[model samples]
Target: MLFLKNPQEAHLQCLTFKKEGKSIGFVPTMGALHEGHLSLVRRAKEENDVVVCSIFVNPTQFNDPTDLAKYPRTLEADRRLLESVGCDLLFAPQEQEMYPAPPVLRFSFGHLEQVMEGAHRPGHFNGVALVVSKLFHIVQPNKAYFGQKDYQQYLIIRQLVADLSFPVEVVPCPIVREADGLAMSSRNRRLTPAQRREAVILHQTLQEAKQRLLNGVSVEEVKKWVASVFAPLQKKDIRLEYFEVADGYTLSAVKDIHRHKEVVLCIAAYVGEVRLIDNVLLFS
Candidate 1:
């Protein structure tokens, strides 16, 4: 329920809580509260004594200026929702407070940052890593929660933590989806009713791909099947960014699906102008 708008104040609060022996759990998010975000908050509430949810729409992550401008900001509603989920603190740092100067340092993830969301949105993960690094420092929580809906983002953060030696644990939670299977996202707000209906295809394609694999289809066959499923969507004004089957752990493209190696079927597409991503795993 307590809100801190400055990093220094939030850092002091976290320090005070640490002195008082309260364990902190943090959920970092951009606002426009949704059920998916609330799900993360609920998990934080269960495991840590004090839960801190941050609502700063990181400016650096957006590839398009208009997309950044269009991103919904409903802090008041988000605050009420966080409180309802029993979150103890809300760190709503202003742009100036968080980024006094333009970020100079960057994070490079080698091959991991060269495809999928990275290929489409250049420097996006660097922005993500920088802001996340800043928040991790500011909150200094015992644990931080992130949704697997952003699987690569979760992976990159895990790598960032290991590389920088952030003391907090980065916990990856499952992707929260809607009744019709569309993955819940903060950007879902931008979808028109017609576009929302079309958005279901992303999940549907992934499901079909998964079922095909379950039916003993070869990896090459499944890749072709997924690509074919997406072709129609792309023609229908749903821009297909990338669709591939890849190693689950490394996120590397799987040329020939290995039996013992776990792989994921991932896709990113634009329904209307709003880009959506969804993925599923294929395990032998």
Candidate 2:
């Protein structure tokens, strides 16, 4: 349960572990730990000799300044959760440690970065790519674990690793949900009791959409039906950003959902001021 804050310390520790021929697994996260995050850690522990978890709420990844400010930070609790999950090391670096000055290099993934979450958040995936690339470099593990909840992020990270030859395996774990079916998220803490209740609709909408698609509904009709389910909430205080059906790997709008190898129903909207995202994968 060693906590290493500086790059020099972590780098030395990782080098020593590598010298001993221990396989390293990395789980990068922004704190306020939840069960979903622990799932990744557990997977890493099972498959690798050393599990390294990073807790840095990267400032570069936020499109909304206020949203960044509101993001949760529960470091002490996160440490305890990581220890409970049998994490070998935790790298909780400060902003200055990561970047003493603003970053100059930017990664552009073309169409992959322009659709879905990228289109909605604008510069969001770039920020994600940058921070993830940085963390991947810092950890330099044999394998890195990520949750399937952020399917697009997983895809982009895979692409990043492939394109850059990062020399690490990217493993995606399944999404962990609440008893009521709401996808687990650190942002779930921000939801009011009432908002939390309505948040369940996000998963319900995804489920109904999945059922519709399975019943042989067209892509257009599937989109319309899913939209109709959320019609009631659209007029409410909640800000409905986008409800879309996109190619799971390509992240483009599905013209013929029936022909697609795989499709993911992705949604992003504000339940009050807490912006939440959830997706379900449909295989053809």
Candidate 3:
């Protein structure tokens, strides 16, 4: 696999592919590579002639400075994993290259940005949009792959593409999870052994919520059950940030389960200091 740190150089390399009438598949990630990330690369390789993967832990995306400092960075191991997955080019750029100065322009999703992760982490998706827009421009791939583990983020990026008219196809891949049903995440590296055991409960709660919602339980009752599931873990520092059941597309909160055709169960919580998120489509 070829690696280039400069965005200009990477764009030039991708341009060569375009000149040769080749298709490009892009996977943008903040590194600490795991099977979940490699899963996206493998799919990209299968679909496009040249696959470009980028590893830049964008500073703008993190609302907490400590959280930013704690994020794992294992570029060497990440590179080896990318190469093993048959990635054609790796565009790992420094923050300065991606953001020579503080970004002035902002992306506003309005109602789309007003719920869940957006409500918790202010200015988070704007930063996400900035980085994704930059990488989309720098790589200019035919298609870009994103995991559904970040279901809300997936929606925001799709809006970014449609609103701004980025000439790239946005592809949504399924959330790759552990055998125990814990969704794979870069933040999973920070979980203590005990916290790791506790983290699986997020998925478990979502599974239970889905069944309850399907079984004619009221929306309020399901929410109550989910809250009770985590009430006993207070001493463990496992706190539920938010539990939302909403339309799968618009993300509007579902007041009545019977009224919605397609809805999802989204949950966020802290397994100790590590914040984790997971979701399931209650019905489609």
Candidate 4:
């Protein structure tokens, strides 16, 4: 697999592939390969003639300085994983290469940024929009792949494509989970063995919440039930940041699950300083 660090060089390479009538599939990631990430790459390989994966832990996306510092970087292992999945090219750019100077542009997704991650992580989606727009320009792929674990992000990028008139298809893949049902994450590496065991509670709580919502429970009651599950985890160093059940499309907090065609349960919490987010979609 060819690795290109320069954006111009990567653009030129993709241009050549475009001239050859090859459809490019791009998977953008922060380096630290995991099963969830690989699932995107594998799907890209199946659907497109060329698969391009970029590994750049974007500094701009982190709202907290310490979170950026603690974010994992396993480039060598990431490269091996990409190769194992038959990735055609890897555009692993440095910070300077991606942002030669500070970015001046900011993006707003209206209400999409008002709740969940956006409300909690100020300037988080703006940074996400900045880096993703830059990467979309650099790669110029026919289609881009993102996982549903970050369902809000998937929605933001979809809006980004439509608003900016980018001719790229945004594909959302299903979430990949561990055998124990914990959603796979690069940050899973940061969890201690004990924290790791407790992490399963995040998914378990979501599953139980899902059943309760289906069994004619009120949205508010369901949310309170979720809080009850996490309330005891405080002693174990697991703090719930937010647990929400909102419309899957508008992301507005749903008063009743039956009112919306689709609803999603999204949660963000810290399992001993390792912030983890997971969501489950329920269709009516």
Best of the candidates, lDDT: 4
Which scores greater on lDDT, model 3 or model 4? Answer: 4
Per-residue lDDT of model 4, residues 44-69, tens digit only: 99999999999999988898999999
Clashing pairs in 1: none
Clashing pairs in 2: none
**Candidate 1 on 1-284: residue-level lDDT in tens?**
89989999999999999999999999999999899889999998899999999999999998889989999999999989988889999999999999999989978998788888899899899999999999999999999999888888888899999899999899988888999999999889899898999899989988888787778787788777777776776667887787878777788877666544788888898898888898887763
lDDT of each: 0.88, 0.88, 0.93, 0.93
Candidate 1 Cα lDDT to native? 0.88
What is the alpha-carbon lDDT for the whole of candidate 4? 0.93
**lDDT at 240 for candidate 4?**
97
- lDDT of candidate 2 over 1-284, digit per residue (tens): 99999978897898889999999999999999899999999999999999999999998878899989999999998999899989999999999999888988888888888877888778887878888888877778999999988888899999999999998999989999999999999999999998999898888888888888888888789878776776788666576678888888888888677777888898887898898999999873
List the candidates' TM-scores in order. 0.96, 0.97, 0.98, 0.99
Count clashes in each candidate, considering only residues at least 3 apart in sequence or on different chains.
0, 0, 0, 0
- TM-score (C-alpha) between model 4 and the true structure: 0.99
lDDT of 3 by residue, 1-284 (tens): 99999999999999999999999999999999999999999999999999999999999999999999999999999999999989999989998999998889988999888999999999999999999999988889999999999999999999999989999899999999999999999999899888898899999999988998788889999999999999999888999999999888899999887787889789999998899999998764
lDDT of 3: 0.93
Q: Which candidate, 2 or 3, has the higher lDDT? A: 3
